[model samples]
Target: MKWYKKWLLIIVAIFVMIPLFIGIIQHNKKLPSHISFEGPTYKTDELEFLYDLTYQKNEERVLEQQLLGTALEIINEAENFLVVDMFLYNDDYDRDKGEYPNSAQKITNALVEKRKDNPTMSITVLTDAVNTLYGSTNNPYFETLEDNNINVLITNVKPLRDSNPIYSSIWRPYLQWWQPSQEGFLPNAFNPDGRKGSIGSYLDLINFKANHRKIILNESRAMLTSANLTHDGSSYHSNIGFVVQGDILKDIYLSEQAVANMTGYTLPDVTFKSSNETNGELEIQLVTEGKIKKALLGALAEADEQSTIKIGVFYISDRQIVKGIKEAAKRGANVQMILDPNKDAFGIEKNGIPNRQVAAELVPNKNIEVRFYDTNGEQFHSKFVIVTDEDETTLIGGSANFTRRNLADYNLESNLVINMPKTHVLTKEINDYFDRMWNNDDGQFTVEFEKYEDQTLWKKAFYRLQEFTGLSTF
Candidate 1:
């Protein structure tokens, strides 16, 4: 070969090999301490299940939101120290869409008021970098919280595994040095009229990982929910939550501390009063990252002929979870799922690539049934699964959706695993919540499987490709 041709071939090989090497190392790198964690199971009597619902009644949308209200109440009742980690904490929405509740503003006011009332109290708010559009624009909410002496930390998601490794591998080596700045003319992908973002912001956005944990806790109690504090565009989206008081709060605090440590912030030292009692009726465990997937799989594996599995989630495209559901159905367990139709993202239409294709794969079994929530202009953003046997009920829920990005250690996710007797009030309440939506008792909540069924061959191929390669967002 000619000398010049040999050098050119070497250069081409280098360009291809660099990203491949980076992608492999980053995906399997040793995560920060306590990334994928599973807290010990604690028994306690203080477990409350709360949910929010938006349904059409008499041609009008009726909102029955309880999770955010309960979260605000928790914020107001904190006395000494407060630690909150929310995925979304901004009020950016389409202003042309009539009127919507300023949920983020309400949370800010509550935090500021509480800070004013207790000047010595320690308050820390942790949120994802997406709220700032990957630091291209300033977040007003973070500024307001900092102005009130509240510590606000944007989680450093770089250390987390790259979900979209194909793009992130190239960007990490070549373009990650381009820091996002406020001076840019590119249209923001989230909000068109919002502050324009820089090329660096768009580059960072393609990495597609986040600290997607919605949690609030003081020394005494903690609440884990699927709802974000920013509800401007999704105020009426259905959601769910759980409030508990016990040693589990320590586990939650420790999880947040791990994120804080990654972000170079130290959380205030606040000791929790543990309920030493272990045999209480309600048992709870805090699971994060891949642990959430483990807990769900364990619960599903235990389902048998006499068992029933109920899942209500915004997205359900994880392969293992899909196989688990099918195996459970094959074992003669009744499996019913309430899924969003993969449509309506802040007034933007979405192609039903995932859920519709997944539902098509699931509904063939006689024991399995699937239904899509009847969303008018909002979404069914709840994420929880309930598996009931003759003796006990297992409920897994929090911010983690059943997706590769959310469950496979790619994103920082948090969830709670609650195990209680069949007769427990919390279990009954959760079952009732599912039944109301499944049966549409007095409300037009869910539609039949035929409503949005899609068996498109290309979409199925696309969903499989996206789920396997982590190329598309769930």
Candidate 2:
């Protein structure tokens, strides 16, 4: 070979090998101590389940939203301090599609009003960087909060492990050095009419890691939910939330503190008073990151022939979870799943990649039943599983979805596990909620599995590849 050709070959190999080495090192490096946290199980009687529903009743779109109403109430009642760590907090949606409730603006107004009413109170809002398109633009809601003397902290997701390492490894070593600027000429990835994003921001977005926790807490109570403050062009998406008071508030506070600490911010010193009341029949535990997966698998493992497992989630592409559900069904446990059809993004249509393919895999079993949430331009975004045994029931729900990115420590996630006797009021309420949707008691909430079942061989292969490689968004 010619000398110049040999030198060029060497340069190509060096460039290729560098990113490969970085990817492996970053993937296996020791994570922050607080990443996959499992808080102590606390027994308390101050748990309330809140949900939002958007269903079709007699061809009319009916909306019954209780989650955000309670969240606003919590903000209003907090006198001393308020901490909100939401994954999405923006109103950058396609207005041509539909009219959303302006949830992001509502949340901002509530916080600003509270701050004005209690001038001395400490208010901090922590949110993912996606609201600003990874710092390529300024979010008006955050700006309003900051201007009102409230602290707005954009979570630094760089410290979190990269979910899409195939792209991030190269970006981290080659492109991450350039900080994304607020001014840009490129069109916005989320909304074309919105502010443009810089090339650096787009590069950073390809890393595909986020602090995907949705939590709101004060000095006294905490709430964890699957709802984002932002509507994302779909205001009527279904979601679930839990509000609790007791020592569990401290656990939620500490978990948020970890994120603040990782991002080099110090949360104000506040104490959560323990309830002196008697322990209720329910037991609650807080789990974050990978620990959510551990708790979920543990609950599934306890199922028996006499048990019933019901899952309603936005996404379900995690292999272990899929396998666990199959195993439980094989053990004679009745398993039913309600999943989104994966057919709607902001306003754009989506190929039913993961959920439809996943449902196709599970429905082949005689014991496993699956249904698609009947969506009309909105998604069914609830992420919860209920396992009912003969004497007790276990419920797991919160921000984490049953997907590799959300549950495998790649994205920061939080969830709560509740255990109670079968006769408990909360247990009955949850069971009734599931039955209402599953059976379409009062509305057309769900449809037969055949409505969106796809057995396409290539799509199944694509789903597996995307789930494993983190190449596509869940």
Candidate 3:
């Protein structure tokens, strides 16, 4: 009967269409980022770490397998010193307090264990003054650290701000000369014991920040990440850490340690044994920011002759970074950018509507490679990049992203760029990851830039204006 024939046709269509629909959705070249609140590890002659973490895309361990291996290797081989900087330090193991043991805790434990093996071996941890004051005690990681004799230092603090906005704003003229870095407009009512004589409190002021994250092992390996020392940051939220080896670790450690001293924090003299250093002709640069946060984007502009750029980020709010990515790819750098694709209603959407959409637009560029990621299922929350220059000097690791605020003028951002490890294994893994992301346009349900590229001129103009006023940061 005709009715039976219609049903059969419909059934066939449903079966065939389902596969097509999935195919359409699953195509994307952006590789599947790791899904773990737990930090990622890689191998290197020496291991490195970056700790201060607030956003993704700027925090995830975004390099190849070998790099992770290098991290583990550095830890295994640390013969001398291990220095770590953490903006957030927690010890409360109770899940009720926060989340699981983050990478910092793991590293802390590892350091303690390592110290037991070598009493002559020294371990130094520079934590933000804020951490010394804040966080839950359920885990008590900090107490263990203090027991271990790790050096604990707090950054400087100033005065307080008037609560009344009208009065606060009106009184600015008289208070203009008054600097919180020196003394706040008014002395804080309550101050911690160690913070006596300081008029302003560390909690009330905004001008000062001590965001620093790094982990260096025996001048061999180092890690850089955006994940804090909280539970949500590790098992529940998202975070990324990079492990680096070779000579670059020492340079980066030195720069960051210097910033710590500038913030009125006590620090030990840090320098690597020359015998352990590498002389790879690879181009390596160390960028850092704290009280003196470095210009992250300006450095990117300097990344000419780049063959490929691998970006993993947590938060991006810098406009200059946007322009730089566009400019770099437009100028022929094979840029593969991976981002947190949490476009759901529950998520806190960033970079506004138009700016957010521009992210989709940048994906399909002829020269650039873009992969939007949403791996909340496991854990792919981090911000970093794996960049290869034209001459083939690959730079891996750090806490910087090509965002308006991160690279230009916003929250303090720090990064450590080191020469690629001698082993080609990690580089190849990263390349493969990028290739997967670039071609799997539908595999990951990515938004196509081509779809929006054809928008009319007027519509584009309207969206551009919206980008400036509508969005806070992406």
Candidate 4:
């Protein structure tokens, strides 16, 4: 063989082999094993479980409830330290929608004001690089936070497992080195503006993993939410949030620190001890990815003929959870699920891939019933599962989508488990919310399965492929 020809072959092999190795490393990244589903429970009157809904009547949009107000109120009252990890934090919407109230900007302003009031206060914000399209575009919200001295850490998700191997294999070796240069040729997929992004950004988007948690921690309290402080999400979705004050808050703070450590950020010196105060007999547990999945499975398995399970989710494509629900139903457990139609995303139409197919999977069981949330061009973005029996009730919820990527430790997530008697106020609140949606009380929050039932073979197969491969946008 000619020497130059052999050299060219060797160079090609290097490029191929390097990316392959990187993909392997990312797929097998180590996960923290110490994180568990056991946490302290506070019995204070400070626990706030809130939900928000956007509805249109007489052609006027009305926010039925403002759940995020609690989070903003927490920021306003903070005096010592504040730590936040919001997944989405931008105002980029479809150009046709014009402009909306920038939730990220609101959060930025709140942090800036708090810092100005107490110059010595510590503030840290952790978010995903997708907000910047993997460095292709700049995030003005994060830039503002940094300028105001609020420490901002974009989560380094590259160290985590690759959800989409086909994309990451090429992205790992070649595209990552070339920064995205928004040549203004192609339209921005996220917003309505005519801004463009490079092919590198598209490759980054296809990697299919994220830091999907939303949390806020301060000296006064801590909160975990399923809502993004982004304007698009704020205006057109139904979301849920929970706030707690006690030793559980300390556990939550530690969980936030663990996520920061993954991105090589040195967390501030903050120690929140468990408060020895009790208002009732409620216990809270902080559960992340694997732990969250395990806790959910355990709760589902606990249900029997006399028990019932009510699940409300934005996405529902996890096989194990699906299997658990089916098996529980087989055992005569009453299983009811309210799921988003998965047909709308800020005016963009989706194919209803996972949810519709998943509903089809469950509808055959007599004991299991499913319904579609009547989103009216919005998304039903709540994620909560409640298992109830005559004696006690178990509530598990947070920012997790019931998808493989969100449950298999491929993406960072946070969920809370509250184990209490069936009569507890929090338990009653959760049950009532599920009941109202299930019964279509007050407003038409849900519709019968016949309204959007889909059992096509191709969609089912496609959903399974994406769910198993972590290739879908759950």
Candidate RMSDs in Å, in order, are 1.3, 1.4, 19.4, 2.6
> Per-residue lDDT tens digits of candidate 3, residues 1-474?
699999999998886665445433322112111100112122234433322222223335332222323444556677767666655554322333233335556656666777677776666666654443321112256567668776555433122112122222323333434423432243322222122223323332323223435344456556665545332234343444655555555565555555455455544565665544344333345554321123334435656544567776644434556677777777677776666543421122332243345565676666765455544332344666665664443544454444432343222345544455434554565565545554553244233444323435564465555334322323
* Per-candidate clash tally: 0, 0, 97, 4
Q: For candidate 4, write residues 344-432 as lDDT tens digits.
A: 88768899989999999899987999999887767899899999987999889998989888888778889988888888888888888
Task: Give one digit per residue, the lDDT tens place, for model 2 in 1-474.
Answer: 999999999999999999999998777677786788999988877899999898999999999888888888889889779999998888887778766778887888899999889998989888888889998998888889999999988888777777898998898789998889888889887786899899889888888889899998997778899998554464688999999998888888888988888888989899676688467788999999999999999998989799999999999999999999999998889999999999987777899989999999999986899999999988899999999999999999999999999988888899999999999999989999999999999999999999898999999999999999988777
Model 4 lDDT, full chain set: 0.81
Best by lDDT: 1
Q: Can you list the residue pairs that collide in candidate 1?
A: none
Candidate 2 weakest lDDT stretch, 10 residues: 228-237
1 against 3, candidate with superior lDDT: 1
User: How large an RMSD does model 1 have?
Assistant: 1.3
* Model 2, C-alpha of 389: deviation from truth (Å): 1.0
Error of 1 at 26 (Å): 0.5
- 178-285 per-residue lDDT for model 1 (tens digits): 989999778877776799989989888888889899998987778899988565776778999888897788889999999999999888789776665666898889
Candidate 1 TM-score, true structure as reference: 0.98
Q: Between 1 and 4, whose TM-score is larger?
A: 1
Q: What do the candidate models score in CA lDDT, each in turn?
A: 0.90, 0.89, 0.46, 0.81
